[model samples]
Target: MSLKYAPKYRVFLFLIFCIIKACDVLFIAYMIKLMLNLASSGSKDVTELIKLATIAGIGQLFFTCSNFFYEHLKMTIIKNVNLVLKNANLNYLVAQAKNDTKSGLSLMTNDLKQIETGRVTAQLDMCYQSILFIGAISFAFINSWQMTVIFIVASIAPALVQILTSRLITRKAKVWANANADYTQHVSDSLNGAEAAKLYNVQPTIISRAVNSAQRMEEALRSMNFTQAWALEVIYTVAELFCFIIPCTIGGVLMMHGQLKVGTLVLMVDLAMNFITPVVTIFQEFNQVKSTDPMWKKTLRALNYSKNPHEKAIDQRDDFIDLKIDNLAYKTNKTNTEIFKDVNFSVTPGKKTLLMAPSGWGKTTLLKLMMGSKSPSKGQILINDQNLTNDWSKLHNYFSYVNQKPFMFDDTLRFNITLGRKVSDQKLRQVIHEAGLDELVKEKGLDSPIGENGNQLSGGQIQRVEIARALLSHRPILLADEATSALDPHLSLEIHETLLKNPNIAVIEVAHKISPAEKAMFDQIIHLNQTPTD
Candidate 1:
């Protein structure tokens, strides 16, 4: 949604303040003109000068208060708009493609920040400058229409300069934004792979790659800045020649010819300066707004993103969920390369199913499909006899997913396990025992900080924490994708037995290797291949 009309009353008040501010400028010009006339006429009376000074002082006071209120309103509007954009971008990101996620991140962080810092000020300035320019020019015309015409005509040069350079400024700004996104993505990737880089002794290589990305981003930023600076310099130079030099020269000639009074000449110069100030400011603000057009377009696009129109909401009734995959197929959206086809499976309530596949097979993909993170290219995923193709939002209500590398926040162990959900101490202890986390709890207590992404915990401990969370959720279906891959053999077997033995819940686990004893515990074993089968 456009924020053009946000905080309507405040915007109206700001416009009124702009008008008051313009009036203040005109009053000051009039007072200066009166003072000049008194001095030129050699009048001994100081009453008019005192009266003009008093009026100008009152105008200055009003101007200051109006300016303060205007700034306050502008900030409030900017804050509201920022909040709206943040919420819209977050909602869109949740449903966006993985490849596009980074772009959304950039928009929410850097792009929004730019709008806050630059665009908000530019918007307010544009409004104020336009009003001030009009008021100042009107007064100048009242003084001498002939000189006002010449002044305005000369000002066109600067406007033309801005118009010509605006496109290049916008183009450079877009390139910089894209480059910055790439740099952000690369930094995120490097940080996520820090452990791998360290273990492989490739820190130097990673650093080099990050430096190169930063350099590219820096170059783009420098280019954008240089372009903006050049445009401003050229425009300002042309504006100075017309707004100051030409007007003063013509006004002086008129004054010498006695067609214009010295007081009137002074007033015209002051008013013309006021008019020129806003005109120059308007051009600068226009360039600034134009430069941010790319970011604004990106933000708008993200906000406009809509899910598949054909997608329907699922019924949210509390019932046991039995999933069925009928001839499921999937392919890469970019390459159109089929990962798998004709995949068939069923996850019945109160039963354990094991999915086995070799490396390069679509094991995780299949699990994601079940969880509704991915959609099947062909066939249907039925949940409790209802098609789940487009109703992925409801999947969370029925299932708990335990990924291979479960993410943990930088919070206490208890917070990570409960995820801010209230749970009884008895139930929490029970799940911790079942998930083999009792020892860790006893050793460090539930209040121990887990560090970022559970870095404080070992791999087995992280997996166990994930299982405990899943168990605590009490969802009917538990989906585990290589959940025990990081655990030792004995711990892996214990976790597997714990999940499979839970008679009240349905479990579907994917693993490349499982012992025969573990395999026998499952009600069915499905192997994913070119044609998946049970």
Candidate 2:
């Protein structure tokens, strides 16, 4: 849903506010006219003055109450719109095949805030001011048509200025948004790699890079602010000159010539000010909305993104999985260089397959392609002779993955192992023992917390915990990308033995180094040689 849908009841509140505000303006004009007439007649009736004051005070009360409700409703609408924008952006991010989280993060945090402060505020201001402008012009025409005509003529120049500079403001806004995204991405990259920076003693270099990013962001923002300021100053200056100064001068001359009564002149001056107020306010609001146009367009684009219609959903109960890759290939977009080509492999349930490749031979990339995290530039991956079709969710249900470095949350050992799944104590103990995690569980009870990313545990222990998680998932296929790379040879052999002996699951592993004895135990060993470009 669009942000406009959020103000379900606020529209009615705004209308009530406008009506009461218009009536208050009319009452004030009448009170001013009465006071002028009394002064002209040299009359001293204190009771008449007290009655007018009482009526004016009552009008002020209603105006204030309406305004209170209006402001409250406006705030509520802003908050609701913010929430809607965040959810839309989040859904879009989740649906993306390859998402740039840094850019998305900046859009939700910075761009959304800009929409709230600039676009939403400008819209509300324009709405309120439009009503006030119409009320003022109607009242002024009733008092003196000549003065009302003068005010409209004065407003023409500011309106023209707004038309002339709108495109420039929008372009500047887009530049600022892009620069902010780049800065956010740079900072996120540095923070994620802070440990490496410290280890390499390159903290100064990282800080320097961050400073450069910040400078670029500041430059873009300064340009946007300058353009907005210049536009606002020109419009406000012209509006003030004609709408206020000229109207007051003309009214005074008419009163002096006896062409206008003192009371009429007072009413004309008040209405003239009221008419100019909205015109000036609208000019400011126009600039604000223009500046926010780019971000709003980005948000709209994200909200309207459609998911892939060709994505197929396989039945979860179909557990017989046989992975077959036919002439698979991949290339990098930036360099247009192939990582691998014409690769053929097959893995079936109840067998152990070892994928052997040298470093930088795209072993991990191949694993990702099989898991549907990345799509091949050539060939198709099939399960049970049907095309896998790059549906990660369907593949996710059939396979469990173990990376060289597995991610762990800062939670208890048992919580990390089960991952919030309701597994019986019997199954949990079985998997823990099978994956060689029994000793760790005994040393530190299941309730004990593992630090962030399992930093408290040794590399072997972390790898065992990851294997335990995969074993407990009960998926038919297990894809491991150097799962035992960090473990000692004996532990690695033990883990490999446990996985290979599992009769119910297929184990496909990428191994960099293995002994002759280890190679003999696998059902099939596929060695990948890098394909040279023709």
Candidate 3:
């Protein structure tokens, strides 16, 4: 998945950098051997030594420059890959039947970080280390194949250690990822309920709950970190003990028998360290990369999500048509408890319909069903006498929803209304005027920033902003679920008037309580007394 998102040219540059880095190391090692041999000679050549030192200095400088670009390119690719994955996952979550907000948040933060560090960076490091190891071992073999073979066979000990412990490390990482997500959810809940906690004087209880979650998350993280560290340490100890002792012992014996020169023996030892170290690093990097498989798999699912089978390519319609709900029913999947049954409703252009039901009734749920966020157990929603499938893609062009507590982005008032669309100023002002937002625009210019969730605006003003947004979309049908429930009677009446005065759009609002004056504003008031079927 990361490869799918990374730019191919950048990856190619990364490989080129790795090769340059390895060549630099080998060139410097060879230079050291030449200079040492010159110093030990009975009659040293001063000019040859100067040339060797100068070449090694040039190689080191080149390596430094390559290292800088290598790090930069590696991080750039990781950042781009993570951003794409996050956006894809967000879209997938929005398209899901039910929002799993906790998991979504977790995926964006902890899981993505894990994947970036473990899979992406580890993969890049493994490639570089493997290349370095190959170059170093080939150089060592050219110097002395017997010692090189001994070191190669001994390097297997560390690889075996990594293979044995890889599974446990992966399991620990998954546990930590889950615990981190739960902790994030707990923190979000605590912050969102801050006002309620203060009103109820239960801040201590909230703190205690958050602390418990944090402790569990930390424990899991500690276990995961410790397991990974232990495996690497064991691999390191084994690789060093075998690669160093066995090779050095054999090289010393060969030099004593006049089969190898002291200069070449020293060069082989230096090269042997390079070869053995990369072998250990490669195994360690591979283990770390394997630990992120769980997160990578989750990301793949999001990127590979398929469009709804019933989805249509149509985006907008130029005409309005009647919407009908016939014999509608719904039930909970877990409890198998019926919410409502045998419900019926209809709305046509220029109509203002009020669906009045008790507080415990499924009024909000019904609105969700109409908005295509929720599906009914048995029924059909029709537009222009055609079946309306429970898919947002099929419904968004025709229906605009106004929630009781509508969401607001922290941006300029214009963005909150047009949502980054290229709407004309004249048309925006018209919708603003129609939604009773003339005073707001005049007071705080069109570009005035609205704080997070519209905290800068009053409840009535926020409701009006949502109305303004819906009106601007030109969607013919507005399904408002208790849109004015939080406002005072006067404000509620004002909002209802703004909603119902538009003859070009139809309004179907659901609520439990309404002032008679407000109720009179609607063209039709329907009472819902739905019950479960046997």
Candidate 4:
């Protein structure tokens, strides 16, 4: 498949490539002179030979510099293309589904590496070899076009071999890349499920699964290598045989028949040796491309922008509005199962409310829907009675949804707390203290590093940090999904009391159980009980 690298960069790359090719002619001619001089008789002038060698050396230097420039530019093109695809202009389709972090991680690390460091680009380097082959042929024709016939005979063979090899390699690469992603996912799943694996005594099963997966991936890669090797063997056999016999035969015939000078005869031999250089190099490059293409296609396809579901509203509305939900319903695609159907709920202004639901019922889905993640399979949600779907831009302004699992970046804790919002240091400290994280933050400092996903922090501390973030932001509506589940009963009660005291704010907590005191703080309890049909 054709990679749609950024057009501007592609055009610039093509232009530079043209320049590189044009420069090749000068280098080829100079090389031909050097060949002829080396092939000359003992009577030939050494000073003249030295001059030709100097010219050839200069040409070689120019060629190397041009190649270096091409490599750099290609890297720039790849980077720009990848970035443009990653950061959406406005992707609607992607936002409708829940973020699959595992898949995203696989795409970023495993799949991306396959493409960037793999085969197709290797093949692109073969273009230079192709150019070299053409140059060698042109030079050979200068002394003996008859020898150039070798190119015509050998050309189709290489292409045919590459075509068949590429198809097999393509299939193998797909399997290999899939296995790579799967293996990465398995490691992620296993490590993430380490607690469960230990609890269930399934470490053996995990190890077996991991081993089998690695073996399959290894087998696929080996198969690809074998296919490439077979094709290369054919080319090498042809090259060695032709290079040994043809040039000498043609040059000898021309010399004996008095049709060519002795210097030209020697030049033909030298050119024949030089001729294989490009073909060999191009074949190597082609093989690299063969390996890289599948990975490239797979990764870039994943990067394709899936537009946000509420892109239009996000674009159109920007003002803050009160959080509200009307008739709301949702289902999962995997099972076509109703997560919650024909549901209706609300968190009106100036009233702190709690959403109580059984485990796995759809509290998180509902929160995401209200946040204008553009989810919920059916019904309408609103902000201040204004349809949230219709005005998703104001949803974030109106409500802060602190998920059960907080996403901490590799950056600072301070950055995560502020989240680029303009809150003062004192205000940040006050919220942290309110959320009961003042002690932790004091020890580490806000700028102290939090490892990936805050693996360094305890479950309780992470919860408090996220709560601190939501509190510091000061949104009118707070949507907390099992937010206090990580915290101890005492801390959860403190949080409940804090919300109760803030009468002007509205809160929606999706808790498995709220304490009697916490229960008293909430003005209303919205329950999602199983219906007859449910």
Per-model TM against the reference: 0.88, 0.84, 0.93, 0.80
lDDT of 1: 0.82
Q: Write the per-residue lDDT of candidate 1 for residues 1-534, one digit (tens) a residue.
A: 244636778778878888887888888888888888887898877888788788888878878888787778778877877887788778777666456646766787888887766576788878888998899999989888988898898888888998899899889988989998998888888998899999999999998888898999999989988998988899889988887798789888888888888988878878877888788788888778877888888777766777677554333346765788899888877888888888888877788998888766788887778767788899888887888763567665577888778888899999989998898999999988888888999999999998998989988788888888888888888988888877778877887887889887899888888888889999999877834332
User: lDDT value for candidate 3?
Assistant: 0.85
TM-score of decoy 2: 0.84
- Give lDDT per model, in order: 0.82, 0.82, 0.85, 0.66
Deviation (Å) of 159 in candidate 3: 0.4
Instruction: Give the number of the best model, judged by TM-score.
Output: 3
TM accuracy, model 1: 0.88
Question: Across residues 1-534, which tens digit of lDDT does each residue of candidate 2 receive?
Answer: 233747667666766676676767877998889877877877888788788888888878877887787778778877787787888888787677355867788888888898888887678777778888888899888878998898889888788888888888889988998888888888987897899999999999998898898899999999999998998888888878877788778878887898888998888778777777788778777778878877888788877876667555444366685788899989876787888888898888888899988877889888888878887889898888888756676665677888888989899999999998888999999999988888899999999999987888988788888889888888888888988877778877777787788787898889778867667778999888744332
Which residue pairs does candidate 3 place in steric collision?
none
* Worst ten in a row by lDDT for model 1: 309-318
- Least well predicted 10-residue stretch by lDDT in candidate 4: 88-97
Model 1: per-residue Cα lDDT at residue 123 = 82
Model 2 lowest lDDT segment of ten: 310-319
| Candidate that beats the other on lDDT, 1 or 3, i.e. the better one | 3
